[model samples]
Target: MSHHAKDLLTLAKAVIDTEIAALAALPSRLDDDFLHACETILACQGRVIVTGMGKSGHIGNKIAATLASTGTPAFFLHPGEASHGDLGMIVNGDVIIALSNSGTSEEILAILPVIRRLNVRIIAMTGNPQSSLAQAADFHINTGVDKEACPLGLAPTSSTTATLVMGDALAVALLEARGFTANDFARSHPGGRLGKRLLVHVRDIMHTGTEIPQVPPDASLQQAILEMTRKKLGMTAITTPNGTLLGIFTDGDLRRSFEKGQSLHEQPISALMTVSFRSINAHNLAVEALNLMQEYAITVLPVIQDGSVIGIIHMHDLLRAGIA
Candidate 1:
C-alpha cells in the first residue's frame, strides 16, 4: 500500500479499537437498574417517551423506532421542544427514557420536573453515574464510555455507539419479555420483506376458479397437457368427477411418458399421475409452500380444501409475491 493509504488505515483502526474497548465495558455495567427498566416498561400502561438533545437526540430517535417496531409502544420526543409546550405529549403512567451524556443537559433537566408532575416514571441513560440526572431518575442505566474515538476526545463517536447498543439491548430484552414473535414483527412491518415471508398466505396469490389447471381422473393425457399449456403452470391437477384432488401430472411426467413412447391420446392421465404428493392449505404461509416445493423438487402445488382442489400455486407465484 501507498504511504498515505497506510496512514489512513492506521487512523481508522485506532478509532475502531477504542470503540471496541468501550463496548467491552458495557456488559459488566448491566445491573439491577437495567432489570428494573425492562420490568417498568413491561408494566407501563402508556407508551415509552424517549427524550434527549443533539447527538443524544439522534440516538434516542433510533432507539424509539426499534422499540416500537419490536412490539413496544414508544416514540421519540425532543427535550428542547418539550420546554415550549411539546411536553403536552406526556401523560400519566407514561415511561420516560432520558438520554444525556453528561447527565446534565439543561434541556432535558428543564422538563424533568414537569414530566414528574404527571406521574411519569423516569429512566436515565447517561455517562456519569453521579450526575444530577442519575440522582433525579427513578432508575439509571449506564452507557459510560472510557473516552471518545475523536482525535481531540470530544466528538460523540464511542459514547454514542455505546448508547445505541444499550438502547438495542433494552428493546430486545423487553421484546423477549413480552414473548414477541416473528408474526408480531411482521404485523408492524407489513410492507417489508418479513411481512411477505411471514404474513403472505398461499391463498393470497394462488390461482383460483378457471385459472386453476385441472382435469378429471379419466381425462386423456392429451387433454391434461392442453390444460397445463393454456394455464402456463407446467402442471395440471387430476381430480375426480366431483373435483376431489386424486393426483397431479406435471411436465416431468410428460417427459418420462414421452421417453417411453406411450400413446398420449389413448392413455388416461391418472395412470401416470403422482398419487403421493405434497399439498398445502390455502391458509398456510406462502413461505411454507416454498419449502414444500423445494423439499419435493416440484414447481407447482395444489391447494386442497374440503378434499377438493381449490387452487394451484406455482413457483412463479412465490417469486412474484417476493416469498421465494
Candidate 2:
C-alpha cells in the first residue's frame, strides 16, 4: 500500500481505539451526580439553554435539537456569542448546560457570573472535575477520557463523541419521563416522512363516492373493464347487489384471461375476479396501508367501513402525498 493510505488507516484505527476506550470508561463515571443533573433540568419550567465552544459547541447544538424534539424545550447558545449579547437569551425558569472539554473555556466562564445572577441552575459537562466551570456549576458531569484521538493529544475527538452520547442519553431519558409519543414527534416534524406516517388517516387519501370503481359480480368483463378504466386504479371491485364487496378484478386478471385465449367481453367478471382479498379500515393509519400494499404487491386497497366498501386507496395516492 501507498504511504498515504497506510497513514490514513493508522489514523482511523487510533480514532476507533480512542472512542472505544472513552465509552468503556463511562460506566465508572455514571454516578449520583448525573442523576442530580437530570433532576435539576426536569424541574425547570423554561428551556434548557446549552452553551459550548468549538467542537463541543457543534455537539451542544445537536444535543439542544434532540432535547427540543423529544419533548424538552431547549436551544443552543454559543459560548462565544454568550460573551457578547447572547447571554440575554437565558432567562428565569431556564437551566443552563455548559460544555467544555477542559472545564476552563474562557468563553464559557465569561458568562458564568451572569448565568448565576439570573437564578438559573447550571449543569456542567467537562473533562476536568476541578476546573473553574465545574467548580462554579450546581451539578457537574464527568466526561473525561484517557486521551484524545488526535496523535498530538490536543484535538477534541473521543471527548466530543462522549459528550454527544451523554447529551442523547439525557434527552432520551427525559423523553420517556415525559411520555413523549410518536404522535408528539410527528407534531414537531410535520414536514418529514415520520410525520406523514403518524398523522395521515386512510380517509384522507381514499377515493370516495363515485370515484371508487365497483361492479356487480354478475356484470360482464367488458363492464368491469370500463369501470377499471374510469376509476384509473387498474382494478375494479366486484360487489353484491347491496354494495357489499365480494371480490376484485385487476389488470393481472386481464393478462391471465388473454393468455387463456378468452374474450374479455364474453365472460362475467365473477369468473375471473379474486374472491379472497385483504382489506383495511378507513380509520387505520396510512402507514398500515403502505405495509399492506408492500405485502400484497397490490397498488390499490379497498377501504371498508361497516362491512361496506367506502373508498379506494391507491399506492399512487400515497406516493403523491409522501406517505409511501
Where does model 1 exceed 4 Å of error?
A: none
Worst 10 residues of 2 by lDDT: 262-271
| lDDT by candidate, in order shown | 0.94, 0.90
Q: Write down the lDDT that model 1 would get.
A: 0.94
Q: What is the per-residue lDDT of model 1 for residues 1-324, given as tens digits with 9 covering 90 to 100?
A: 999999999999999999999999999989999999999999999999998999999999999999999999999999989988898999998999999999999999899889889999999999999999999999999999989999899999999999999999999999999999999999999989998999999999999999999898888888998999999999999887788999999899899988988777776888889898889999999999999999988888899999999999999999999998
Task: Report how far off residue 154 is in candidate 2 (Å).
Answer: 1.3
Clash count, one per candidate: 0, 0
Candidate 2 lDDT score at position 201: 88
The RMSD (Cα, Å) of candidate 1 is: 1.5
In model 2, pairs of residues that clash are none
Give the distance in Å from residue 52's predicted Cα in candidate 1 to where it truly belongs. Answer: 1.2
